[model samples]
Target: MSDWLHNLPVPMMALVIFGFTYFLAALVFVAVALAATEERAKSLKAISPGMLPVLGIIFGLFVAFTAAQVWGDSDRAGAAVSREASALRSAVLLAAGLPAEQETKLRGLVRDYVGQAVAEEWPMMAHQEASLKATPPALADALKLVVTMMPQGRAQETSQREIVAALEQALDARRQRIIVSLASVNSVKWWCLYLQALCELLVIGFVHCDNRLGSAIAMGLFATGVATSVLLIAAHDRPFTGQISISPEPLRQIMPEAPTGHS
Candidate 1:
């Protein structure tokens, strides 16, 4: 769940998860096989195969529950970014209603804000370091200008009010994305998930203790399933931190010709 692991490309991430699961399966098999004496085999055989289905069900439930949260976070992150871009686009269009000088300044402000978001805020979001403790300065200045600017007619007056509304929408969208960026699977849930998996692996070993070949094959298949489930969840767990994260292209499109370097 570390950033290093999440940032790996999909194929490499799959390899790591599969390899770890296989190794753990092998370890459990070796331990159980070593202790499988003739009398122990009899007792081990008594461990009902019915428990296999029961344990498997419990493990599946854990994976399903965890996956739901991860998928939700990803969806929310994408929506927030899209909504922010749309609001900024509205502001840029509405600026045309103002005097030529004021319109130019408002457009420049939007450009500055998008550039900062791409070059500065993005990396911070990826690392879960973007905080809402301070307002974005470019957006703040735009809001102040819209509120205080003198309008000569109904057209400019309506534009000013709508621009303020658009800026507020963009601000709310920014807050949503930052909050979603901070989301991740907590340690307690991870601990529970792994512990459940280990229990299932142990049960498999007990059920097939007398036959090493059978034990290995069954565990290997189950391990593959476990690995696949884990990989799917982990790849999308931290929406902004991973290779498959939501992009800033929507924001960049608002001011396509502007440079994206931090000032």
Candidate 2:
């Protein structure tokens, strides 16, 4: 069910589901209002003057909530990319302290990792892969060797410990980047919020139907509002998929060449 929902084309899905829901709600509202009018036509000859203001307040609150969620998700996705890039850059600089051959090998692995993340992992994340195959076994081996090659003395050991710490930090950052990328998809809350928006639109339509604002004005407002919300949600959910996504330029710029000696 989740996969089916995610695979839906954005505009069509929003229109079909939200539109149908709003239609049902509007029908119900109209039916109830008609029944009330017939039952008390003589005694209660007036529509509630407070209905518009009440609906407006409710709609405003709903819009604000949706906006806040979208904004929060957008910021998180952007921060994740920045944090991952900073960690990768620091790891690359730290690799310079290793022996020349080790340095070369480690840098190569880092470069490959970045490239694979940009080119391959971004796509796989949409399918909900926890992490990418960026750090191969060879890279892990090189990291282990860096730990083993520390000189035997308190001062040198301390420096080695710092290097190890940095390496660990880098690995953690990489994992976090992958996790955030995969997890940024809209949560169940998003669906519920969308449903609420549709309900609000239906209520709006029923309340204003007597004003005779014409179908175009009514639909235009509802469609525009709903589409904007969905687009914002989808963009944040798959930050790396669309044109507005966080670019891989930072990683690409720092990509190192493959080292010699590895077959």
Candidate 3:
């Protein structure tokens, strides 16, 4: 699936997939039907219908394998965002254990990080342009501030340790999300899926070549299934790129009032 198709709205996406699939099916029906002579029709009818079930099974497996990766990426992307948000919230709470001035500064740093993530990093991730080379400055500063501060008491010492841990977790979660954002169904798998589907379509044409009406009906129904399966999988193939993408709302929820520049 191309980025242009994935980026389309759901209804438009469906129309394109369904329309293209039906067109291909019609072409197959016409080619087979017109080419079938009386003697050839007898041979075509003799072609085992049993092969149809086998081809259908193979096509189903292709869809299953492809869909598994797509759905898994979506699930992982969601989990990573949620974990990052949870870690940031924990750090904010732990910041309270510091002195008023230090705690305020620490909270401010967290806000800045979240704000930048929502405004800048998100768009980059959407296009798979985000890189690990770009370490978030705010998080780096917060880590520095927390690690350098001398704990005045047991409570402060605990807060310092926990806040550091929280920040680390947040960083890890961010890394996970960015890595998952880069995941997509590779071209080889896509080719395999389509080729298998084409094989099935050809088998439908072969087995029903003697009867144009039966051929048309079988191809239409199968094409619809193939198109719908493909549309559903392709829409989510690149978890971060599509209209069904994971949003930065989890990060935004951390500091709704934080000043954000451009998304």
Q: Rate the local accuracy (lDDT) of all candidates.
A: 0.91, 0.59, 0.88
Ranking by TM-score: 1, 3, 2
TM-score of each: 0.96, 0.69, 0.94
lDDT of 3: 0.88
For model 2, what is the alpha-carbon lDDT of residue 81?
Answer: 65
- Model 2 regions more than 4 Å off: 1-49, 132-139, 152-159, 184-191, 214-216, 259-263
lDDT of 3 by residue, 131-244 (tens): 998789999999999999999999999999999999999999999999998899889987887788777887888887866788889889999999999889988887788688
TM-score of 2: 0.69
Candidate 1 — which residues are off by over 4 angstroms? Answer: 256-263
Q: In candidate 1, what are the lDDT values of residues 93-116, reduced to their tens digit?
A: 999899988887888889999999
Worst 10 residues of 3 by lDDT: 254-263
By lDDT, the candidates rank as: 1, 3, 2
